[model samples]
Target: MTAVRVLLADDEHLIRGALAALLALEDDLVVVAEAASGAEALAMARAHRPDVAVLDLQMPGGPDGVKVATSLRDELPSCRTMIVTSHGRPGHLKRALSAGVRGFVPKTVSAQRLAEIIRAVHAGNRYVDPELAADAISAGDSPLTAREAEVLEFAADGAPIAEIAERASLSQGTVRNYLSAAAAKLGAENRHTAVRLARERGWV
Candidate 1:
């Protein structure tokens, strides 16, 4: 049998190393590339063109796993993407599915289970952890608009309105409006509380 080529992307060196080592034991799976950041993950994906990419959900220094999956959906449709996240927030699961990720699972899964998921995804089947799917179903849809969500993400780090405006390329007044709207929708007294609430609900 031809081994399935896999790309492993995670920022944590020890976890990535351990995962790569564990996956190496599988006879029908071979890790072709490894990356420590989302940017490097994209670069490696382009360079190696693996059959499946198992990405960490929150890699730094570039796009997150969902963003990378979306990009791959456009640039390399042949490659299947899956996310393994410790967070496993309902919103994140929903976003991953929307981004064309073939599988979504918690980091608590065994390596053997993860290998099975990879094979399943490679066969054009989708998998989502049952608990996560149920939680997403109950969480309901995010109330924040696309622009509101974007602006709130900018405000996540407590950046001032001017900085957020510059980053989002909107006027400071517009930024304040979005923040106010988002806070109101979330029933938060301020943008800071809104950010916390949205994060807890995985809406931001």
Candidate 2:
């Protein structure tokens, strides 16, 4: 059997080393490349063209893992992609799915399970950590669209409406409307309640 060529991308060297050690145990899996940032990950993927690419969601320098996954999905169909992230935000998972990754798993998972997930994805199976899937399902669909959530997240951070509008390139009126709508959807009494609720639900 041909070993699965794997490309691993993460900002943390320890994490990369640990995962590499674990994956190396399986005779059918081989770590072909290692990268410290999303841009480096992409460059390596293009160069090595691994059979599977594992990416970190929030790399410091360059487009995020989801963006890279989208590019790989479009340009390299035979190379499966997975997102391994520390953040368990439901919105993040939803967005990752939209970007066309084959799997999404939290970093808390056992290394053995990660290897299994990679194999599953290589077999053309979709996998999402059960915990994350449950959170996503119970959290329900995102009540706010991306723009609405963006505005509210800014407002929640105490940014003035005008500043929020300017940053989002939206009119003040539109920003206000989005805030009001988000609050109403969250059953929040006001902007503060909306922010707290969104945070608690991992929707932000």
Best by lDDT: 1
Error of 1 at 23 (Å): 1.0
lDDT of each: 0.95, 0.90
Clashes of 1: 0
What are the per-model numbers of colliding residue pairs?
0, 0
lDDT of 2 by residue, 1-204 (tens): 899999999999999998999999999999999999888888999999999999998889688889889998888877899999997888778878988898999999998999999999988899999999998888888778887788887887777889989988899999889999999999998888899889777678
Q: Candidate 1, which ten residues in sequence have the lowest lDDT sum?
A: 195-204
Deviation (Å) of 143 in candidate 2: 2.2
By TM-score, the best candidate is: 2
Superposed model 2: Cα runs more than 4 Å off: 145-147, 169-171, 199-204
Deviation from native of the Cα of residue 203 in model 2, angstroms: 4.3
TM, every model: 0.87, 0.89
Report the lDDT of model 1 for residue 22: 95
